[model samples]
Target chain A: MIAELLFAVFFGLLLLGIHRKVIARIQRRPGPPVWQEILHMLKFSFKTTWIPKTASAALFVGVVLVAIGIWSAALFVVISGGSLLVIFAIYMLHKIVEHGFGLSSGSPYGKFGGVRSVISAASEIPLLVSVAAIAIFTHSLLISDIVSYQEVHGPLLITIPLAAIAMYVVLISKMPFGPFSIVESKELVSGYKTEHFGVWRAGLEVCNGLKTYVLLLTFILVFIGSLPFWLTLLTMLILVITLSFVCALSPMLSPYDSVTVQTLLAGLMLVYVGVLGVMS
Target chain B: MKKKNALALTLVAAGSGVAAMALSMASILPGWAYAAVLVLAFPLFVLGLGLYWMAREGEEDIPFLGY
Candidate 1:
């Protein structure tokens, strides 16, 4: 437990550093310094807190903290042999709360962000279904148990290639990289975060990094079970590089297109997995 | 003059503390020892800050993340 907790935090920070570098490279700009995230957090800690005139102060604070807290808990649960149903429920609750907070802000961009968030949630359902299908195949949702199954039954990847694909689709949609970068759309003038500033902006940025680390960790566990730590780390690096390249090369697309492609691909994967389950 | 050095040292100490805590949590050390070391980690982190402060004559404009 101690090890897992420490590993989680360490990886989280390392990921923050890596993300800054990745984004910098992608934009062909010297992005924020590698340690910028930590420095920014320190700077934000000392800054004056600001509340928007049109927003609910209490709700705004709650929204920011809730997003951080929920995300933290979800990531923690991902490590412990927790129930999958519970994990899924918590993940959903986090999204719903995020949307509610956006709507509560009463800003036009917040409203737009809320709507975009809802659409993304709608698109994520098929991916969740794939999780359920995989759970059924292994007859367990505890990560440890699932990994053990792999030792005995073989890696889940070979059997559930389609589900693996589904997971990738879900990951991209959640991270919403490349073409699906609409949530962070500059044209929306920062979208949900337009009204947020100072420490609040800092919190959101950390949360963004946290979400990336947590989700990537999830992908690693699901797709590649217990390996040597170095190997796991290396695999993660490679995968992120590939995603970064894809993001750079691909043209940004409309949210509509994002939702469509993600849902269609995920749906296809789910069906294939379903058929595989029936056959085996 | 001393106060400024102390403040920078404190900030560095905090940064290192976070890093050490993270290491203790993630490392594959025996669980009980890991927990005990993590507790000790905080003070050692502070000591580190004190050392950094003593070494500095007086400096502001601390480098980002170097601490």
Candidate 2:
């Protein structure tokens, strides 16, 4: 557990490094230095933060803090051999609480962001269902048990291609690339995080990074199974590269369109899961 | 701005490096399960990077935008 937590911290910072790169690519102008994200975080952490006069300062901070807390709970679920259902519930609850924070901000941007979040949350249901199916099939919700199942039954992907596809869609939906990024639109003035600044923003950014690593770890551990220690780490590296290219090449889909795509993706995946279940 | 884009691209390239490592690991492990890890490993890593960068950008504060 300690090792995973440490990795999450390091991986989260590494993500900041990637952000500097991504922002550079999106805008035509030359960007900051390579290690700019780290610098930005350092600066933000030290800077003083102000609460909006009208804002419920406690709730504002509480929402983001709780967001981190919920994510940590989800990660702990994976580490401690808990029910996948519980993890899913915690993840969902976190989203809801975040939405409440956005709405409470009483900013137009925040309201739009909250609405976008609702859309995003709705799309997550199918992914959660697919995960449940995997648990049902493997007869356990524990990450290690699922890994063991893969070792004995072959990688779950080979047997359940649709489920794999669904999982990917879920993964994509969670992060919001291009069109799917309803709540996080670059054009929007801060989207859900419009009012936040300084350490609060930094905390949220770090947590977002941590969530990314945790989700990736979940997918890899569940579907990929146990690799030799060194090799397992290596495969993780490769997966990140492939995902980055996919992001670059794939045209950004609008959030509304992403919803349509996710729906279709989910339906197809459901059919595939049904078939797989019957076959096995 | 161009520099930022280049940096992002470069960091993504690093993600590829991680993927390569995963491939080699999958090869040494027992069975196709390991191979599957090799296959999905790089993409998952990229996904992580993508989510972090994309989501973090959402947190930027705009001056003219209503708080």
Candidate 3:
């Protein structure tokens, strides 16, 4: 378990680093090495730290803990092949983590970040549609069962392409600097994370690594079915690279534009789900 | 963030981490029991360790009042 958690922390950050490098290259600039995020996690952990005086002391610190905790639980759920709903629920809870990180700090930027996170809540509705589409096909919400269904019926990506696309959009939105990532837009000065420094920020980094790992792996397991261990790692690499390409080419949207885009996508997904539901 | 508080948090983190691993591996415990232990332990573990590391003595600048 320790080894698994460590892998999530290290390899997840490594993937993020690769993501940055890919984006930079696409934009014609050198970026940090693939190990930079891991180094960053360490660097933040060892820095001087303190709570902001204006902060709601308990909530300010509490959210960081919850951020890591929820993602860790998410990892376990994926590892155990538990209900997919649980993972989505945890992802929803992640919105609260973002909100808390911003509001509890008593900083205007952080508060705006928090508010944007909630507004961006629309971004996750397509994920719900995707999950519904999956359940419609498999007649089960359990990951283990879904994988078994895919094993017998071939990959869901081939069968329910729209759902796969919906889930992909979700993973994209979660990526840094993507069209919907306004909560952390530069105007917000790191957005929700502006106030969480030193060890606190390191903890948030740990959570993010685990989140990236779980979300990517879940997408693979659900849509592509399972693979051999090393193959699974390779698939994740390819998957993130694919996402990086999309992210690299796209410009960040204005917050309202982002919401319009997400809402429109969600509407399309809902239509797909509605059609799938009626057909099934 | 004091020394004594930091030490306590660290111990909680260490103990919780160990317990989570143990419960997951235990044949006698039900799966939900292990999950419950983990749900409880995880936040404590992350929070504890972060605070422990944050306990270093310093005369840092006041909180960001504004730019």
**Candidate 2 local lDDT, A70-182, one digit each (tens):** 66556666665566676667666756765865665666777777787788655676667678579657978777788888998988777666666666666665553433667
Give the chain B TM-score for each candidate.
Answer: 0.37, 0.35, 0.60
Per-residue lDDT value at A238 in model 3: 96
Q: Model 1, range A171-223, lDDT digits (tens) per residue?
A: 66555346676665766666667666555655565555556666776677766
**Model 1 stretches astray by more than 4 angstroms:** A1-10, A23-30, B1-67
**How do all models score by TM-score?**
0.73, 0.73, 0.94
RMSD of 2: 12.1
Which ranges in model 2 have alpha carbons more than 4 Å from their true place?
Answer: A1-3, A19-35, B1-67
Q: Deviation in angstroms for A70 in model 3?
A: 1.0
lDDT of 1 by residue, B1-67 (tens): 2446646655664555456556656774443444444334333332333333332332222111111
- Kindly list the per-residue Cα lDDT of model 3 for residues A52-150, writing each as its tens digit: 778898998888878987888888789889999999999999999999999998888899999999998888898999999999989999999999999
Worst-scoring 10-residue span by lDDT in model 3 chain A: A1-10
lDDT, residue A31, candidate 3: 88
Backbone clashes in model 1, listed as residue pairs: A6-B25, A6-B26, A7-B26
lDDT of 1 at A208: 58
Listed models, DockQ each: 0.04, 0.03, 0.47
**Better candidate by DockQ, 2 or 3:** 3
